[model samples]
Every structure is written in structure tokens, then in C-alpha cells.
Target: MAVNPPKIKVLLSANERLQKLKEAFHGKYKESPLFYACAPGRVNLIGEHIDYCGYAVLPMAIEQNILAAVSVNSSQTIQLANTDPKYKDFTVSVNEITIDRENPQWHYYFLCGVKGVQEQLGLSSMTGISCVVDGTIPASSGLSSSSALVCCAGLVTMEANQKTISKVLLAETCAKCERYIGTEGGGMDQSISFLAEEGTAKLIEFNPLRATDVKLPEGAVFVIANSCVEMNKAASSHFNIRVVECRIATKVLAKARGLEWSSLQKLGDLQTALGLSLEKMLDLVEEVLHPEPYSREEICKILGITTEQLSKNILSANTHHNLICRPCVS
Candidate 1:
């Protein structure tokens, strides 16, 4: 199996969206675009919130995706524009790519992808790019719109700069780089976005990134329904706090089990250490953690660490140290 995204030579005039995006790029920059890149969003098929624990997650790429028409330029700034007017245009110097985690804007997500590729390729300097982005994925709808945007941007930058990267490497880099926008998540979204193939889902496992294709049962029908609630990851500290709580909880459970708790970050890590089942893990949780929410003081006491260490190692950029939450979601 090829580990790289397939390169398709496009007949632009034939594909409607490509043609439209090309025209839009020409209209905006007064020049024809050089190339286009696309990356799909994903849907978790079975489970989530456990991939970070070194557990495998089942997810599949969706039809909706983020697509961009891009061209290299002598100008030293990267320019970004969206098809939707609600998302404002943005530009940044090629050498000065900063992601504003405080604002959590759409452009910052794209810049996260670009910055990720920049770091991966070790390019201290790169030519500027002008890109027109068009996305069909609904934002904040559990469709991984944000991760897809980042992956699309990463692919676009790599192609425009004439760099080569494997799909797995791209997925891993894109996963870590999404932290620029303050989304503290595992690589499930980015993995499935880049690693998934048509007509099959993938079991994405991290900490050495591997993807295994899984064919669905014959005639199994699944419907994806959005709840109309926007669960924006980067904008919400609660999300990261929940992640931190889980991390801390893993430590507590590990210490109680007479295992090294300090280095472990996910419950999956703890489970793997002792080789326990999900039911056994739950039993351990019931025995170790009380019904009440855990205070930061209590967590520190158990871990034998100071608040500074917790913030430095466990907490995410947007999450606060005053975090007092359950170690596991009830």
C-alpha cells in the first residue's frame, strides 16, 4: 500500500469546483493558480476521547473537505482568503507565522498547518503563497473541520514549496501542529483525514502512528446527525481541562496500582502497563477515585509534584491550573 497521498494531474476545466476555485483565484490575484490541494474531514465511527491514551480509534474520512487553490509568489507574505465572506482574509510574513490561540480564528488553523510543514521541512525561509480556500465541512459539528483545514493547508504548502512528505508523516505532523490553535487532542482526526481510503474505515493508533483499514459489515447503515451544538475545541478551555483531568486521573490510578504514574499521560497507558480490560479499568477507577471532584491540591499530593510542574507538563496552553474536575467522564 502506498503511504503517500496519490498525486492526480488535474484537467482543471473538467472539474467544476476546481474550475470555479481557479477562476476565483484568478479574479482575486489577477493570475492563474499553479496547483490545488484538498484534504477531507473525518467522522469517528465507534469511539473517541480515548485515543490520546495510546488507544486505537475508529474513524473514516467524510465527503466534505477543505480544498485550496494555491500559487507561489515573490512576495514574502502568505495570503489566505476563504470562499465564505464571514471568514475574513488574512496575511502573514513567510518568515513570521504566528498562530493566535487567544482568538481561535479560521486563518490561524491554516497557519498552524503551514507552520507545521515549515518546521518539518526545516526551512528557515520559504517562498510566499497565495491561497484561496473553499471548505464544505460544517465547522464545530464533530466533523473535524478544523483538523481538515490544517491538513489541507499542510498539503498545499508542501506541494507549493515542491517538498515531499509521506501521508503518515503529514498526519503526525499535522496532529502536533494543531496545538498552535490550542486544541489539545490526539491524532485521530488528522490521521483519518490523511490515512483513510475510500469505502473503508481505519483503526488509527498513535505513539508510532499506524493505520489499519477495516471494512464495514455488509449493508450496515450509519447516519451522522449533528446536534446543532457547536463544540469548538480551540475556543474552549473546558475541553483541554477535561483532557488534563483525564491525564491526572490516569496518574492517580497508576500510582494506586503500584505502577509508575508520573510519566503516563493517558488511561490507555495505565491499562497497558497492567494489561487490564475495560471493565477492570472501570473497577479500578471506582476503587481509586471518589465521587467528588478532585482538587488541584489533592492531585498534587498524589503525584508528589508542584503546581508549576503540572502546568508545565500536564496542562494545555488554554487550560488553567485552577482545574478541579473529574478524572473520568461519568
Candidate 2:
């Protein structure tokens, strides 16, 4: 007999505020006949800062996710509420694409997703809706809690319209929406959340949509440690700076080799265009961008970087430390 997939219960909590909000909303919106959808947060196991470059990423959807209750309105305005104490009531009109830094704070991220879907579908106006969001993931540990919110909002909106949506299209729309929020993160998080199967991890390659299943090691427990650090790139410009730097590096290398950088679709393509091995390409990236220290010195020289600058640059990148990538071992 074929076994049914095990049921997973998602817990909603923002340090205890979510429970109260859930109860309050359940009472207030109970008679409204709202529709609900969920999208989970993700943990990237490998390939950090490499997804935009067309490298493979290993990511898994966690049990924690954002549960959204949505009800359509007659007007073309979107209203949002978060179960957390930090977030307050916010409203937006579909015709306007403005970011509000102050009030109705939680809606900003979800609105980006809506904007992305709208732009992709060429819709002049979106169905006005009110959404109540409840999240279970940690705030800023790099587990992609923000992406989850965007995707869940998009899913809720699409379902409310009774539209048939594909998982791939939803993932792409969510990824595009994230760009509106001013973060140039890869599409790995949204893609993984939509595509990942329970009890398995996925290796995702962005261009052309290549995904492979990666079996989790037996008896292994995946633990996400909260660092109590809330770093959002929207407020600080550091994340944008890194994105610009990467673009610059790609352009420079492409010019040096007499090729158009835009034509280079994958990280592998960039490596081939530059005529550099994986180790050499990584070393070159480290030498110029200097995001982190070289785990090995011999690898640095092979890519044409002096040892003196390597250590200093790597140490500098370590100060903002939150989540470190741990390699998957056999």
C-alpha cells in the first residue's frame, strides 16, 4: 500500500504575540469567509552569494511558515495586519507602488510580492484584500523568513481570484517581488519553498530551472541557531553595495575577456568564459571582492591574489557574521 505523507503542524509565534493575534483575527474575520494559504521559510545548506551567479544551491523548506488569511475587498486597496506586536495596520492602493518605512510595517515585504505578481501578469489593478500574517521562523538568521511572507501573500491573492497558478510561476513572481524591496538575493528561497518535498533537500540552479533532489543524511538533525540579530538590507545599504560590486566584477572580467557580461547566464558559463577552473574562479572572486578569508592559501595564489591582502579582507568580512555555511558531507 502507498503510504500517505505525514502531516506537519506549523506553530505561529513572534515571541508569544502570534497566539493572541490568531485568536483576535479568528473572531473578527470568522464571518468574512476568507481564504487561507501558507508558504514556508527556507534554510540554504550551501552556495551562499552564488545563486545570482548561476551556481547550484542546496536548500530545504522548514516546518515553520507564514499562514495568511485573506479576504477580497471591492476597492483596489490592500490592507494588511501582522499578529506580532511590532507590526500595525497598513494599507496600500494597487495603483501606487510606494514603500512605507514607518506604519503598517509588515505589509512592505508582502506588498513587494504583490507588485511582482502584478507586474508579471500585466494587471492594471489587483483585487483589494485584507491579510493577516502569522510567522513561525526566526527574524534575521538568514533563514529567508521574508521570502516566505511574500510567497504566501502571492498565493493567497491568486487563490482568491480563483486563478490556476503554477508553482514555478509563483516562485518566479515572488523572486521578482523581492527585488522591489531592494534586496538582490537569489531566487533559491522562494523556489525551494515551492518545490521542496518533505524529508528531502533540493539542489536548485536558477537559469532554466534545474532542480535535483539531495537526500538528507540519516540520523542528522538540522538545527537553526538564532543569533538575536535583526539586520535588514532595506534600512542599511550594505547589501546593495555587495550586489553592485558583484555586477561590477562580472562586467570587468567580461570586458577583460572581450565578451558581453550579460550573455553569461550561469556561474559555470562565467568560469568558462574566463578560462578559470573552479578553484581559480573562486580565488579570483575572493581576491577582488574579498567577502571572506581564503580557507586555503594555495588556492588564493592559483587565482593571482597576494597572500597579504587575503587575510585582512577575509577578517573584515567576518565582522557582520550571522549565519555561516556548513558544507554537506558524505
Candidate 3:
């Protein structure tokens, strides 16, 4: 989670993308970048969904990554520009680094990372930097592109500020900061991005934030083809709806057994509280919950709470805003 060592001219010549990004930084800011930071996009080989549910996820870092060429500045403003013209440039004062959750722009994701690092280090005055970003990962393709960008930004901020932190802490901070953009991630993307070693995949688990190496079969290749279908998880409700559904389902099950349901969120945590095996959890799901979608009223009634109470208990802010029939205000 520190600055990548300065690449000599020959090494820069060897890596075209790095060379190009360095040139882009010079072109945009008219100054040589001090250093570069990069974090790779990851594709989950298995269990992407269960990561947020307190389960381990298997992901491998892809070559495609978000790269930033950065130079510390005395201007007191963090400026960002992307190699891709479609992503417009952004600038914000170091003291006013705020994330706009309502608008999940590309820059907000980067800001999420910067803000995370700033908060973690408790830096009263952060070092402003001029950054030119380049990314090869396809956005909205389930390749963890946004998370990679956040990780890269966090790493860059740490370096620019001359701060030091462990890779695990950096990963955890990035994962939490992404919530500023209104995505509740389970750390698979950030964890794999930071902890991945070349030639090996990782099984990422949270709570303690540990990674276990998973050796793939020799000569195995994972080819990912994008259909070009695009949906920003932060901008769309489809992703968070599933998260909310899981939260409500966990609470529903907890309430059915007379447990303090509001405190429960993930199904895994609920099962842990009940001390039930996966088999018993399945049986409990069968006995307590239904296959079909439950109406807002039905959900409230099942939890023995009012619509307002249910609304407060069952959702994160971003997920709550997406509810079709938002609980009525009295």
C-alpha cells in the first residue's frame, strides 16, 4: 500500500501502458509525475454474491487495471483527469473532498478512495496531487473495475501524503470508502486487488481481512467476454435490491425465531446467532420464509413492526431509497 518504486527508463519502455500513462500525465499537467499507482480489476471465479453475506469469495486479479500517474501539488486541490475522454476531469479542494452518492460518477469513486485514506490517516491537511488515470478494465462488466479505481486512489493518496499502511488495512479502507458512492461491497474486489500475487488467485475473507492462496490448475485460462451490457451498481437499484432482500430476509428469519432481528443482516450472521448448521438454516428458510416476493406491508407485518419501523430496520440508506413502495410517513 505504498508507492511503487520508480521505474527506470528501460522498464518504462518495456511497459507501453505505463509509458503512455506517464506521457499522458505530462501532457495534461505539464509536469513529470512523482510516482504511479495501480490496482488490478478482478473477476470472481466463484461466490461473488456470498461475499457480502459474510462468506469467502474467490477472485483473481486480471491484467487489466486502473492506473494513475500522480504528482504532489502545493495548490491544495486534488485534480483528476482520465485517459478516456468520456470520463471528464475533476478537481476538488483537499479539505472539501466529498463524495456525491446521488451521482455515482467515475470521479466520485476515486474520491471515495482518497477520502477513505484521508480519514484513516486522520490527516488534517492532505497533500494535493495532480492525477491522470488510465484504465483497461471494462466498466460495469462485473470485473471489479470501480473497486480497482477506488483501491488505486487509496494507494495513490497514501503515497502522495507520505503515509504508510499495510495492504490489508488499505483494502479494508477502500471497501468501506466505496460506501460513500452508495455501494455496500463485501471487500472481494478491493481485497483481491491489493492482496493478489502474480500467478495465483486468492480466496478473500472478511471480519479479519485475510487472504488464502488458491492454486489454480496448471495451464488453466479464464477468458472473460463482455456482452457490452452496462449497469453501474451504484447508479442502479438492481444490485442493492438484492442486498436489501438479503438483509430483510435475514431479519425476517431472526424475528420468526424471537431473536433481535434488527441487529441481524446477513444470512450467515443470522445462522451464526441461531447456532444452526447450513442444513438447519435451509430448513428454517423453508419453514419461515416463502419463495415469492413479499409486499412492503407483508414484510412489516411479519416483523411485527409498523411500516416506518420496518423501513428503519430493514435497509441501508441507498437501498431504502430504491424501494418501490417506500414506507409511508405518518
Candidate 4:
């Protein structure tokens, strides 16, 4: 049985935006869009960069989002056009979708989501699509614009294939597929984007992957200011380096406690094994993992794994450049 997504109520303002998107799609594709998919950008008010380590994140979807108007085609080719002229149009065969990490274009991010849903549904070939993507989120401003794009693409693909999926399932699939673009995120962005309810924030937890609504204080107004600078997390090695640091720290902590640490990839897994709270986990980090940077040889000695195994298993492509890993406890 095909599961249905949660009922979404579009307000007058959102309806106007959809109408504009529909008109834009017709202008570009010379045909009306069958349906529109939207995924909002997110703001992580408290948690930062810990989601990939299997930690809970408190996030909320912002008003800005990536919206896509799509129509299915019989051309066996996926055609993409952007409402923004800066992003050039792209078309590819249904069976040939390639996401380039080196030169990460706007279209490649959309393809990441489409390819993700395609792979998740086990479809060897996908139906051709004509899509016009529009977004208001500031690119690379740490507000999950890329993740929103991926989520939007995933939804478009699912609807185009005539498959129904729950918001939770779509969020999970989109999160996993985002790794195709070389950013190993913790899934909070996509989760809140899909699972968010209007007028409330969400406490997004991982591993089991659930969300609980968090009410805000009455009359509290939050403001977000962009620095007008951009950092592509996938293009840079900084984000992955932190992930590697945490992994090494987990293995070292696990090895110290006399628990088999090889299988422990997440700090949350270590916390579960020790039955420790977040405070206790911080205490454990100070006790076991030192502040000094750990070299490749030192980490290998502690984990009893060779340098080759370390590179293959623990370190990602970006982390290989930095052999000295620091435990980012503070």
C-alpha cells in the first residue's frame, strides 16, 4: 500500500507563491506543471555540526524554501530550468544522472535528490521530467539551502513516479541521498523541512529518527542575519574533518571502556553503550580523549588498526588531507 504524506495547508501567501511558480513553469516549459513540491530551508538555533554523530538537533523551518514545479514527459530525458537566469538549464537522460562534486552546480543538487528517490524505489529507469526550480533561501548561508533543494527534488521524483511516501520516509531518503553530493549531514535539515508543522519548532532526534514539537515563548521574535559570505560544506574539507574527529574520539572512548569499539561509528552509540547522559558524555570526553591533536599513528595504536585500515574505514576523502585529528569537545 502506498503511504500518504501529511495533509499540508497552504496559506494565502503560499498560494500566491505557488501561482507565480506555476506561471513561471508554463513560461519555461510551454506546458502547465502537474504538481509542485516545496522544501523549506532550516535554522539550527542551538545545535551545531553534531547531527552526523547521531545527536538530536533543535531546528525550525524558515519561511524561505526551494520550490519546484514539475511536469512528466515521454522524452526519456530530465529537463531542468531555473527561475534564476544565473543557473544554466540542464538536461540528462533518465538513466544517466551524474552529480559532480568538484564543480557543484545548482542542477546537480536537484539531481542528487532525484537520483536518491530513484535509487530508493529501485527504479532502473525514471520518467522524464520538465522542472522549474525557484528558491528564496540564501545560498550557503548555513541555513540548509542545499538540503532543501535535495528534499524538493526527492519529492518531485516521488510524485512523478506515481509513488506515495510519508514525510518521514521522504526525509530519511533525502538525507541518505544528500551524501551523494559528498556532504555527510546528520539529517536535521531534511527532517524539519518535511516534518515541520506551522507555528512550532521541532526537536529532531536521530538513530530512531523522530520529531517532537517544541513551543516557543509567547511574543518571542527570532532574527536571522546572513553574513553575505558562503561556504559550500561539500566542497571544503572542514566539515568532514570534524566528522572524522568525532569518529576517532568514539573509537578511542569505546576502546578505553573495554567495549568493542570497531563497530561504534557514532558518539550516540557510545553514549548508549555506557548509558551516559550528555553531561556525562562530555565528562567522558575530557577524561579519555585529550585536547592534543591525535596523529594517524597514535590513533592507529589506540584503535589497534593499521594506517591503511584507518584511511579506508575511518577517514573520508577530505579527512585524508589532515592526519592530525583533534577531539572537538568544546
- Output the number of the TM-score-best candidate: 1
Per residue, candidate 3 scores C-alpha lDDT tens digits across 94-151 of 9888888888999999999999999999999987899999999999998989999999
| Clashing pairs for predicted structure model 3, backbone only | none
CA shift of 212, model 4, Å: 0.6
Off by over 4 Å in 2: 1-22, 26-30, 100-104, 261-269, 272-276, 280-330
Worst 10 residues of 4 by lDDT: 1-10
Candidate 3 positional error at 77, Å: 0.5
Q: Residue by residue across 1-330, what tens digits does model 1's lDDT show?
A: 336777889888788988889888998899988888899988887767777667788999888999999999889899999988899999899988888898999999999999999999998888899999999999999899999999999998888888988999999899999988888788899989888898899988877899898998888777888888898899888768777878888888888888877788888878888899989988888888988888877878888899888778777777664666788733
Where does the lowest 10-residue lDDT sum fall in candidate 3?
321-330
Q: Candidate 2's residue-wise lDDT over 12-62, tens digit each?
A: 564354455556566655634355677888888988767766678899999
**TM-score: model 1 vs. ground truth:** 0.94
TM-score of each: 0.94, 0.75, 0.93, 0.94
Off by over 4 Å in 4: 1-3, 6-16
What would the per-residue lDDT of candidate 4 be over residues 6-26, giving only the tens digit for each residue? 435555356787888888888
Q: What lDDT does the true structure give each of the candidates?
A: 0.86, 0.66, 0.84, 0.86
User: How many clashing residue pairs, candidate 4?
Assistant: 0
